[model samples]
Target: MMAPFSHTATGKKAAMALRSQLAQGAKFLLGLWMAGVIVAMFVIIPQYEGLGDAGRIIIMHVPTAWVTSLAFVVSGVFSALYLFRRRVSDDASAVAAAEVGFLFCILATATGAIFAQIVWGVFWNWDPRETSILVLLLIYAAYFALRSAIDDDNRKRRLGAVYNLFAAVTMPFLLFVAPRLADSSLHPNCAFIQGSQCDGITLELSGARIGLLGDSKLELKSLERQGDLVVADVNVTRPGYQVENHRPSFDLASGKPADRPEFDGEQFMLAVEQVDLATGTARLNIEAPGSGLLGNSRTLLTFFASMIGFTALFVWLYRLRAQLLMGEEWLAQRERTYGFPS
Candidate 1:
């Protein structure tokens, strides 16, 4: 036999207390997240290939993307649980995750648009990735619309769970499969894609490159000697990162800094306090024009902090959403004692 309504309502209050206590950790995590965001934006290295400083936007953009994916997955899992158990609490959790996921999707879209404007010279180009994101946004909108249109709570929950499941089913296809199927896309080629040309580098935790002011941070891999001029094939890694290298005519025997040739092209002047050829590096007393806020060796710290901090933020947001859902269910149950309908 089903439990009495009064008894069930009391149980809901107990569950809410437990959830509220657990959610306190999420609040702490959110605090850490905001602080980390500030540091990522102002005190970290700009991660651009060519667009100079605007590359700092990736700190927000990439994290939002990751969080969006995570939210939807959580929603899907809870929706399945709700379907199996037919619990109001489980349904609320599914809804909470979906709503939070949608918000992150919006953040990801907005950040991507800003980054696109900086590099692609346009916003909303409807590239394969952009199209996929748009599709996901539309599906989420439809799901909410469906829920709002329904009058009965039981019907709404059942339909919403089904819709959430459908959305989850489409997610991997829209986010991953469809983008790859497209023959042409403005999106840069992945370095890890076997048998594909690598026009860009991967942003991963394991790999790193370091450099000082006005230094050859990385070699032009296709560089070749053409009798007189050393042909330097600089990869146009969009919004290029790190120091810009000029094709210098001088070589190792050209007396190093004393015989350094003039860079006729563009330059980011970091005041040369000293250039040590013996160590094959230079020390700058001034800042690199487009470098991010740390402006010194501290820029290295931004790299690890941003990745870890953003990930923590995503976890906190998902937890907070789950807690909010539990609170919502508890309030509804409490009101039912006064003949309030769910």
Candidate 2:
């Protein structure tokens, strides 16, 4: 029969071997997932009107935010389990999720700031959505501080559970409710309201439609103030339609619409008029008959790609954290058994 020490050593060796195998599998899966993410960036993301190249950033930024919220949810759920079962492993799971979630929250905020800078021409505006996300980060950070302040394991776990439960209660209100309290927000939200009506509006030159495809005549004249007026006459074979003066006007091509129709004259004359008016000249795009554009399914692909990639990455990190916590517990137990520091 095996001695007690010998049996214990064998069990440890078996556990380590199993862990090594799992780690290798995780590494392989992560590599494959990353490959797909790259493919989405290069081959799948599409250029749709105003959201052309810059739209690529949308995938990463949104995912980071989503992952943050998901992490908090996980932390809360694990905290609840720890309270109900009083398991040390459950407490470890809750902490791991909270820490990783906080990291994801920071990433989401930073990425969003970068995107906002590019699109809105500013960074760190106190937009309603921004405020909510910022508050969430603070809450998660506080959870960590709370955990650190307590040295007793049982007490810490109990208090942590209660704190996380309170924190979870606030998430829906802060993230979903608070932002929508304003009349309008730069943030995106999907509302399923009863009796909602769409505000009918014409699509602009820089909206949902794709690029202008046609021949154009360009005339540029230099002005005295080192500025110039450009008049371009473009003909589109197929035009998008808009109701102007209650009449369906076919825009074979279109440029940025003026606050009002700035010109009802020749393109060159309008450009000259714009120069004197000190208003920028608008390029004239004349659509022929039926050429408003739509996307080529690339936008959908990009959405899925970014969503899947970010979710996979978040799961990987969360799992890794949990595993490390488990390893720490194992080492602590081993130290006690061996009567030595590991």
Query: Which candidate number maximizes TM-score?
Result: 2
Question: lDDT of candidate 2?
Answer: 0.59
Task: Indicate the residue-level lDDT of 227 in model 2.
Answer: 23
RMSD (Cα, Å) of model 2: 13.1
**Residues 79-193, model 2: lDDT tens digits:** 9999899988888888888888889888888877876676556788798878888998898789989988998867988999999989988887887677767433444332111
Where is model 1 more than 4 Å wrong at Cα?
1-26, 46-49, 189-304, 340-342
In model 2, what lDDT does residue 318 have? 82
Worst 10 residues of 1 by lDDT: 197-206
Show pairs that collide, candidate 1: 48-239, 48-240, 48-241, 49-239, 49-240, 49-241, 50-239, 50-240, 51-239
Global lDDT scores for all candidate models: 0.61, 0.59
Each model's backbone clash number? 9, 11
